[model samples]
Target chain A: MNFIAEIDVMPLKELLDPQGKAVAAGLKNLKLDAITDVRVGKHITLKLEAADKATATAQAELACQKLLTNRVIEYFTFEVKEA
Target chain B: MNFIAEIDVMPLKELLDPQGKAVAAGLKNLKLDAITDVRVGKHITLKLEAADKATATAQAELACQKLLTNRVIEYFTFEVKEA
Candidate 1:
């Protein structure tokens, strides 16, 4: 079986986001007054082949830990689709 | 005009991702031995009403800073579409 997954990582609200801040400033330069804040992150979409949905999901999670995200600051989730 | 945006944030590789690691372990429990890595983050989709694509993009970026994500660790981007 194969599955598709969408994953993401972000800074916790209590944390500071310099990248976001820089983006915010950049947005301001674009003259968007209604915009006040900016945060940044990554979104990954991929398909996995495995024996079952459960197995595929497990593999996807493992992939997230080792290759998709760093272990110190990121948190992630996904809805897996079997094909 | 209106636009839809997808946004994400993640830990840099230099940073540690306890969240991704935890997810990886959880996946191991699910019996997905083939999986090798995991990373975690947030994804948001929203529609913005504005005067132009450029203006809408600016507003979308602002929304990301103030509402969509936290600014400490997150950096984000989007592809805006007029609706």
Candidate 2:
């Protein structure tokens, strides 16, 4: 089975996002005055070929813990769907 | 108008993804032997409250350039849909 997973990695809320901040400031230039709290993060979509959902989830969790996140500065989770 | 945007940010291929590397190694524990090239990145879904579609795209792009990417190490783009 193949699963499609969407993952997000963001700095903790308490942490400052320089990129997000810069983005917010730039939006101000374009007259997007309604925009606020423009937090920025990364998104990744992966195709995981596993024998089953359990295996796929395990693979995803393992991926999150071992390679997908810094745990110290970032966090991640997946929305798994059949592919 | 409101827009839903999906964003992805990843390290340039030349930059090593330590977390991605660690994740690949961990998948080995799950018997996912076929899995390879498991690069990791972040995903963010944004709701841009704007007056029009063109404005929404510009806001989203500004968000990417000024906040979302670290040009030295990362890059990003968006998938915009009507909301």
* Cα-based lDDT at residue A59, candidate 1: 64
Candidate 1 chain B — worst ten consecutive residues by lDDT sum? B39-48
Q: Give lDDT tens digits, candidate 2, residues B1-83.
A: 66777778778879888877776666677666645546677665567887888887777777777756688998776787787
lDDT of 1 by residue, B1-83 (tens): 55666665555546667786776676567666554455565565444556778877776767666655566665665677754
**Top-DockQ candidate index:** 2
Candidate 1 docking band:
incorrect
CAPRI-style grade of the A/B interface in model 2: acceptable
**Fnat per predicted structure, each in turn:** 0.23, 0.36
lDDT of 2 at A49: 83
**Considering just chain B, what TM-score does every model have?**
0.77, 0.93
- After superposition, the stretches of candidate 2 with alpha carbons farther than 4 Å from their true spots are B1-42, B45-83
